[model samples]
Target: MTQFEINSDISVARCLSPSFYLDDVYFESSRDHIFSRTWQFAGLKSDADNIRPVTLLEGFLDEPLIVTYDGELRCFSNVCTHRGNLLVSESCRGASIRCGYHGRKFDLSGKFLSMPEFEGVRDFPGPEDDLAGLEIREVAGLMFVAFDPAGSFEEFFGPTLGRLADFENSNTAVSTSVYEVNAHWALYCENYLEGFHIPYVHKSLNRELDFASYDIRTFRFSSLQTAVPAELEKDSGRRQEFDGKAAFYYFVFPNLMFNFYPWGLSVNVVEPLSPTRTRVRYVTLETDPSKRKTGAGSDLERVEAEDQRIVESVQKGIGSRLYKPGRYSVKQEIGTHHFHRLIAEFMNQGGAR
Candidate 1:
């Protein structure tokens, strides 16, 4: 067992124990309390365009979820009512979604349209037989879904989503270089919520950002890390120029990160695969093509590599017997403490499995 301690001297609380990261039972609980209850970025609004007002997004928290747009926007579980076959195998545009296996048809709203072979069955089109509906919400052009109907996107995102409202509505195109990284989802989130590791883990990034001037602010369920260049630190007047350096990082509750750079923006969605495995999906949003590669944020590949190396190392360290819950640096790690507190609160409420 690992020993844990909290430092009351600091303004912020310490992080959870190493067992929270390493224990399988704890991970299972988090899947429900944290992941299922929080809003998850499903895909872009443009994805629905390809399928012409209807697109199916697959693999949301290990469950298939479909998003459709006819006159209104809706999402439903992509599981068939009869025989439990997956409803939508691949994204397609059509009048209705029909299961390929049994030809059980469903309208855009997940209403039972018709079943080919069940003519003799009583109460065939009952409400219980209809597809399970999942809650869907959109911010700007990005779409999100929640398995728990009681969860509210506004409540889960809180001020983090509101802060980035302008950037979200900008005329930005999704970058082609969509990156998929393999790691524990929580580790990626932990790395994102703090700037404490920037100096040690990211040497090139440190050169571009003023480590001393980095500002971190905590909100209800999220946090922000703002970075300004060394030259611009003293001059608050020169903050909004296209070339002027600024990076606004927002971690929204459980597993979404919105990074706004002088160039444009990048959205990160963390998806857990198992207790020790996760997928980090990066979607870039930018209006100016030329500005995509500017500032310390330009070298995305290098920065991503630096982040991956440190986070994976931390994951390994947390599994060690010598490791325990660690204290937070009040000035540096308040965002991390905020995240841990939210996790504890949700778990205490029986949200965790």
Candidate 2:
């Protein structure tokens, strides 16, 4: 592990070594130490709707998991209980998950139901025969799961959840066009943590947001970046339309971003696909049913494309041999420092149980 002098000096809080971003060994270690223990946004509540016996959500952060709803919502290791065959092929509704390999069956709640070819084997169906259960939690319409049960979901996600309570209470339904982007997951997160690069990287976005009034504040394992128009600049002020209104970009530690606009919210869940690749799933939740197709929120596809271009370039740059760790602009990147520290803490704790 890379060691640093932890003191009052903001200069010491520069990003992790370039190796942390480039090395495969470091990436694998981070997956075990940090990602496994962290709470990951799995899917939206709408994804878990109806009487679907099995909902196969390809796991983020290297742990394969599936959420199911028969009578009760449950999360289980996607690896089958018998012979280690993967249970569900895709998202579909069924009475139970039947292993395609050997037809071993499991109920929606991950309880061992029955197996066809195990009649002669004594103690064939035991606890080991049941799908491994994972802790599942929900905030608003978002469903989250932690591979490690010992880690508290509330402790990890409380701040963002509290901030989102009011918007959730408005009962916003997810917009159908859920956009997905490819980039390094942490790159996406680091970008969202602060507005430092917005003016230079996001020309169109910079015009929309007031950079002078943009401020970032940190709360344990979470951070909020507030962007208000220069005209209506105050510590706190409200606007009618989302065009020049206050936008709160909330970064819940590890991988979730809740971007609050006047119209509604945009939830970005960053999922690491590989050492160098990632998928950002953007789910837009809108309360104003009629205004969904208009205003600032409507141009999501363009905004996402802009973000992808910049992040992908950064990903390529971080891998270069010439690159090393650099200083953080104390004025601009305190939130990013806080994020790196939290990541260090989680990783230093070692793997979760």
Candidate 3:
């Protein structure tokens, strides 16, 4: 199997093969080749303040995990080794984790503790008996977990998180919405990669931004899309109070969006359910209540509804036999092109492109 190669030059690169979004085999292969090998959110760092069990990608990867704060916070497998039982079922501060099935015990750090009725057993305890600790990290008060992570946390999210360090602190009042949509996860992501559809599809949004000045900036594993407000472009002094005259839309590879506005940050996590089903979540953090309903970030629900409609339409359009590979609009679709390149790079692993 040869690795998938993307043409570095966007001028001639064709769009990703439609089969990448339509095939069940390709969808399943992505579980290991992509998702599992990448970092994922495991709720906020506050979830670890009190030991709690958190499920990673509940409807997909479905890994049972937990975070315990024993003076310091640490993440570990929620499963007990003695018998396959969930060790902290709910959120609570616990000195140690205990399995209800066999009364097997482990310390907060996932070290093996004494078990019942094993007095005379040979090779009483081994490394396998201890709970498995995962590769976990906390960035800007958000908890991130990964199984067989491909690289360091910085490698996965250096640009987006680093850019927010000066402006934000702990996440406060995070509003989350999770639901399934009838479309490939990648399809929904590509829709977000470019601002090209905003002027045509988002009527209310079009009034807020100066789409002519909108630009897509690419990073190592992420891309930034900046939108200058029409009013700010006309009067710069008017937006002097905000971070910048433009709204920042950042997309982290695979499935994460860090959208920053004058109000705060709106985080989107895309979880795939199947070849044509996906789970989308929105986590919003507001720093300034005054900026909630103004500028580019306002009317989020309306924009989302519009996006859902068009992306689902595209999902069906791509399935048509008459449809063939498309070309990228070099000026506006650079983000989508970068995404396709990464997708191809991963998909080609362990198989032919």
If candidate 2 were superposed on the true structure by all CA atoms, what would the RMSD be?
3.9
What C-alpha lDDT does candidate 2 achieve relative to the native structure? Answer: 0.70
Worst 10 residues of 2 by lDDT: 48-57
Shift of residue 175 alpha carbon in model 3, Å:
1.7
Among all windows of 10 consecutive residues in model 3, the one with the lowest summed lDDT is 344-353
TM-score of 3: 0.94
Q: Write the per-residue lDDT of candidate 1 for residues 1-353, one digit (tens) a residue.
A: 22233443456456776666777776777767666777777787654542322222223346776778776778887788888987775666788888889899888888888888787888668997788987888777788877772346766676767656776658777753544444566777877888899898888888878888788887666778888776676676646664355677888888888887766778887767665666677888776667656566688789888888777777777888887566778888777777766666666564432
- Summed over model 3, clashes come to 0
Candidate with best TM-score? 3
- Please provide TM-scores, in order, for all candidate models, with all chains considered together: 0.86, 0.82, 0.94
Per-residue lDDT of 161 in model 3: 77
Candidate 1 local lDDT, residue 218: 76
Question: Superposing all C-alpha atoms, what RMSD in Å does each candidate have to the true structure?
Answer: 3.7, 3.9, 2.4
TM-score of 2: 0.82
lDDT of each: 0.72, 0.70, 0.83
Mind giving the per-residue lDDT tens digits that candidate 3 earns over 203-250? 899999888989888876789999778888567675675555557888
Model 1 poorest ten-residue lDDT run: 50-59
